[model samples]
Structures are given as C-alpha cells and as structure tokens.
Target chain A: MPTQANSSEPPELGLSGRKIIYDEDGKPCRSCNTLLDFKFVTGKLTGAEGTKPLSAQAPAECLEKLGTGTVTSAAIGESSSKAYPKEDPPDVNQLGRASWTLLHSVAAKYPNSPSDTQKQEMKQFMTIFSHVYPCGWCAKDFEKFIKHNSPKVDSKEDLGRWICTAHNEVNEKLGKEKFDCDLWKKRWVDGWD
Target chain B: MPTQANSSEPPELGLSGRKIIYDEDGKPCRSCNTLLDFKFVTGKLTGAEGTKPLSAQAPAECLEKLGTGTVTSAAIGESSSKAYPKEDPPDVNQLGRASWTLLHSVAAKYPNSPSDTQKQEMKQFMTIFSHVYPCGWCAKDFEKFIKHNSPKVDSKEDLGRWICTAHNEVNEKLGKEKFDCDLWKKRWVDGWD
Candidate 1:
C-alpha cells in the first residue's frame, strides 16, 4: 500500500526509533539560519514503541535541527561467530574485534575518519550508548550527542528552544571549518598520531 | 546552564528530546509549508562520543528521512511498581496480579494507548523487532520502523526523506486521537467500554 507522502521509505533492515540533536547555542535547528516552529509524521513498523518498522516525516526546519544520518550497523552478521552481549561490558575480546570489524565496515563504506576529538567523542559515546542503544561503537558518537545535549525539560516549547540554540552553534562550526575524516580514521584504527 | 531558548510559554512538563506532531494532510512541517525546511540536531552525552557536545543545523530540505523524538521519562512520581506494559496481551504479567500492576503502571504513565489496529500490529512488530532491538516492547516498535522504512537510502539526503514520510505516520496514530489522562486512568483502574 502507498503510505502517506510524509511516511518513511520503508527499511530493508526493519528498524525504527527517534533521537534529539542540539546545536552549540543549544537550539534545535541552529545549524540552519532559522528554527522550526512545530512538525510531525507517521508510518508502519516491525517493532514496538521505541523500536519498530515505520515511515514518517516532520517539518524541514525541525529535521535540520536534528542532524539525522545513518551509520553502519555494529551487529556482527550471523556468519560471524561472535555474540553481542545485551548487557554492559559485552565480552571484551568480542567487542574489540567487533570494533575492528566495524572500523573496516566504516572505512569501506562512509570511510570518513572523524577528528581526534570526534574519534574520542565517538568512543565515549559508544561505551555509554551500548547500554542504551544497539549498534555498539559504530553509532557511539551520535548517541553521546543525544545524552549530553538533550534537556530534561518537560515542556515541548522549552525543549524546542534549547534544541535551536545548540543546533546553531554546531552548524556554525561545521559551516566554518573543514574536518579530516581519513586522518582521524588512521589514528582510531592503527593508533597513529 | 542556560542550554537553549524558550520561544513560547513553559510547558508543565518542559518537553525535551525529539518530538513529532502532524498536520491535517498528515505531513510534517516542510511538506505543509514549503517556505520552511526541516532541521537537524546532534549532541554528545556526558559519558559518550566526541569530546564535549556537538550539534548542527541541517538544511530545511530533507537530507535523511528518519524519525526521532524527545525521551519522556514522565514517571509522574508514581511508584515503579505501578508501571505497565504498553502492549495489550501484556508481557511481564506472569504473576497475574503483578502483571495487572504493570498494566496499571502503563495505563497511568503511557502517553497514549494503542488503537484496535495498532494493538494487533504491535504484536507482529514485537517478534521481528526482538531480533534487532533489545528487550522491551518499546525497543521492538522502534526497530520495526527503522527496518520497514530506512532501506536503500545510502546518503543523509535520502534518509531524511524516508524518516519524514514514514515515522511521522506511525507516531501520529500510536496514541489515541484525543489524549485524556483522566479518562485513561479510569479505564485502567476499571475496565473501559
């Protein structure tokens, strides 16, 4: 069936969830010149509340603030013998090897090595995010952004404002500078300075 | 610190995280109003990812179609014991009364209830989502959405378009049409018609 125009495109992997992003000024869409007032979208899925298969959309202004993107899945394919632990401190060897594998996965795919700071930040995000989100280290950095920047605000209005300011700062930096992803990757993989 | 701004009056709950609200066409912000665009936001939590926090504002246009929202830990001071499963058949109810207690907990706190069709769809999503997402029905739902919608889109641009279209639709219908906390509480305590 044809879903709504705003629905998701339908996932091949069957996943669904949401995240919040903030800019340097702590706003939702600060990266762009403007901010969003309000928005919404919906669709079907293969899972429940926080997890499912779905299609959805929101205001373009709102999407800009969130900085949404896709990172490689950290789950080892079934062909691999490693078992990913659901709890904290997954088997260290398994995780390390998985990280190594993920490095290749990233390199072969996006191949963008984040800055030293970005790499370190990604590592921090991975360690904490594994406990809360799937994909292990592959998506650690993005998850970290969610935890630190997201406000404890209960009001949508306040939350929106916070998102807007932070979003602005972050976007401003990206617009102003150029990042070297390949160099960062070498440091992360071979421990190169 | 003063993380973000508050464009409007403070909400009782002070909302934060990614949130979605739909319009009459069931489209997100930009589709409804072309002059505007979607925004993107990113951040790093205290214990995760890149040093400090980083966020950005994206183009109002769709970069990756995905769904996201603010995390609401609205326990509302109710005892943890009062929490209930958001599902209908209801897992975690092995102990009968204990299960009932969980249902009651959910009834009081769950932002919305599953409609007749959604209740059925959730069951299907849970099974598939379990493979990708961790424990809990919420995670299952989120996983299903990601899998069903975000596929074949290799770039941020495509992903944004996917999320905006799919996630928005499902979220719109998850909770009942009109959310009434008092009414739901009555239904939870005493079976509703």
Candidate 2:
C-alpha cells in the first residue's frame, strides 16, 4: 500500500503538469505525503495499476522533466505546496505511535510531587524534543502544541492529564479516536486489575 | 496477560518472608517489573492461575506489616533489591519502542553534515533523554550505552549507523532479533519500495 512518487497524476496539472513528491535524487520528501492521504493512497484500498500496486519508485517522466530548466522553481514549489500543505513522512505513523508510547509512559512515572529541577528539566526536554523530532511539519505542530498548552510538570497527575490532552489534539487532527483521558492511570500506570 | 499486584508472591521471601512488588500504598513501583520479565510473566504464554491470571494489585499482608515498626527498613530494602537487581517499569516495552522509533527517525532525517550547534543539541538531547526515560534501570543501561559508544552525529550516515548499532545493543540484551544496520535507511527513512 506504499504510494511511491510515481502514483500517476491527479486530474489537476501543476506548472510541470505533475505534482512533485520526490526530490531531484528521486528521494521522497518527508513531508510530501500527509499522513491522512499517505494512509489512504498507500492503503491497498486504492486500485492498483494492474495486478500489482502502484510503485512510487518508478522514475516518472515528470521527475526527469524536472531540473531540465523548462520547469520554473517557483512553479514547482507552488504546485507541490498546493498538493501536500501538511504532509507527514512515509514512516510518520511508526514515528507517531512510538512517540505517544514514550510520552505517556514517561508521564506515568513522573513523581507525584516533582522537584523544581525535575519540572524544569521536563519543560526543557520538551523544547529539545520538538527541535529534534524527525518530521519537520509534525515537529512544527508539536511546537505549537507546547507553546499553547505548555508542559504541566508540577505533579505526575498534572503531567499525565496534560499529555493525554496533547495526544487527543493530535488524534483529532489525524481524525483518529481520542482516548479517554480518565483512563490515563489505567493505560499508563496501573494494569486494569 | 496484564499481571496485577494481587498475584501471589513468588516463593522467594523478603524481610517479611514474602516477595513484595507493590509498595505500602498498594501502588506498583515503576521499576518493579523488568520489561523482560514483564513480557514473559505477564505474557499470555504463562498459564493462568485458575482460568484467571495472577494479580499484583492485592494488598498483601507484607505491606501492612511494613509500617507497623516491626520490620526494619534495611531488611525491606535488601530484599526488594536482591529480587529485581535490575528492573524496568511495567510499561517499559511501550517506552522502549517509542524511544527507538523517535531515535531512528531523528537519525534518519539528520543532515548529512550537521552544524556544530545541531550536533551538540542532539548529543545533549540524548543525555537528557537517558535521564528522563520512564524506566529507571533501562535509563541506566542507556547511560552505559552512551558512555561506551557516544552519539555519532557527524553526518546523516554516521548518526543513522550509530543509532542502528545502539538499537542492536538493546536488542541483544532484551533477546530481540538484531536489525541489519545496512537497512537503516530502508527502515527509517525510505519505504521498502
């Protein structure tokens, strides 16, 4: 279900007459596919070209046509920007699941009454984490999330609830189900005994 | 398969003459279960107690005996330490997977030649990460991993390989299969296509 850059073309035409999802080296750009469309297009649900699914790997005529100087840089940029305004990378789902697991688990173990240093370090860690998160656009969104919500690190309960709400915001954006924040203790800390 | 604190104590005796995983407050300590044993013992692979599995949540008599001033604190500490030796919390696996996902993805996206500030921030992030990792003992092992290998952030390839090797080290300890470092890009950056 992996949609390569070579997934044919949409009805709309770009300046080059095709949207560019890959870079000049034929490497797929991390943000070229939104996780939503990435999920849909790469989903085997999309009809295949023949017996096999579409290979994003094919060196499309559009790719070769690019960098030939016939296509203006501004045209290509405008075209691509129109298509994937908020794309996630190919492995965005993998990255996302892993990040949530870690964030929630860390919040679960936070001290009931954290020291000032612990609280400060946690906030600082979020700042550093946002900077280093693999996906450029996703990181930008996380930065916004942190800026608006900030990290509530005063207590373990505070942090847990805050992170759950943060995760819900992401889920809502992705159109995924929002988890019950009340179940934070059951999911992260105590087993459902 | 979720083991609760009510599970009957192992045959091993502590100062109270019974292994105690839960604290006096009836809350499971974050470091009480190693991810290894957590996977195994809580695994459905283990036969159930009576069509039902053991629960770790039951307030065992040992907890009641602790604060009554009869049992010495030293004895209690010695017993618990001797049993776990090196343990990860209940959600260690969840945390571990998330940490690795973020780590590999970040490495995959690393610039071929990072600026000095970028390199320093990545290294500093690891140090802070090792400290804030949810699992107590797992963090210690990660500290050891960092001490020995250090973060190789010179280039994208350097960091990708380094992170892959680091992941292999953890896999070795956890009895998980080793990943091919050669496939770092294929797994983290690009799709199988």
Best by DockQ: 2
State each model's CA lDDT, in order: 0.27, 0.59
lDDT of 2 by residue, A1-193 (tens): 3333345652122222233244345543443333333323333223342134333443443332332322211121122223212222234455676787788878977889888888988898888788888766778888999999989999999999999998999878754566667767766786443
Evaluate model 2 with DockQ and give the value.
0.20
Top lDDT prediction, candidate number: 2
* Chain A TM per prediction: 0.19, 0.61
lDDT (C-alpha) at residue A185 in model 2:
79
In candidate 1, stretches whose alpha carbon ends up further than 4 angstroms from where it belongs are A1-193, B1-135, B175-193
Q: Estimate the overall C-alpha local distance difference test score of candidate 1.
A: 0.27
What's the TM for model 1? 0.18
DockQ of each: 0.02, 0.20
- What's the DockQ of model 1? 0.02
Worst-scoring 10-residue span by lDDT in model 2 chain B: B71-80
For model 2, the stretches where C-alpha displacement exceeds 4 angstroms are A1-27, A30-90, B1-90
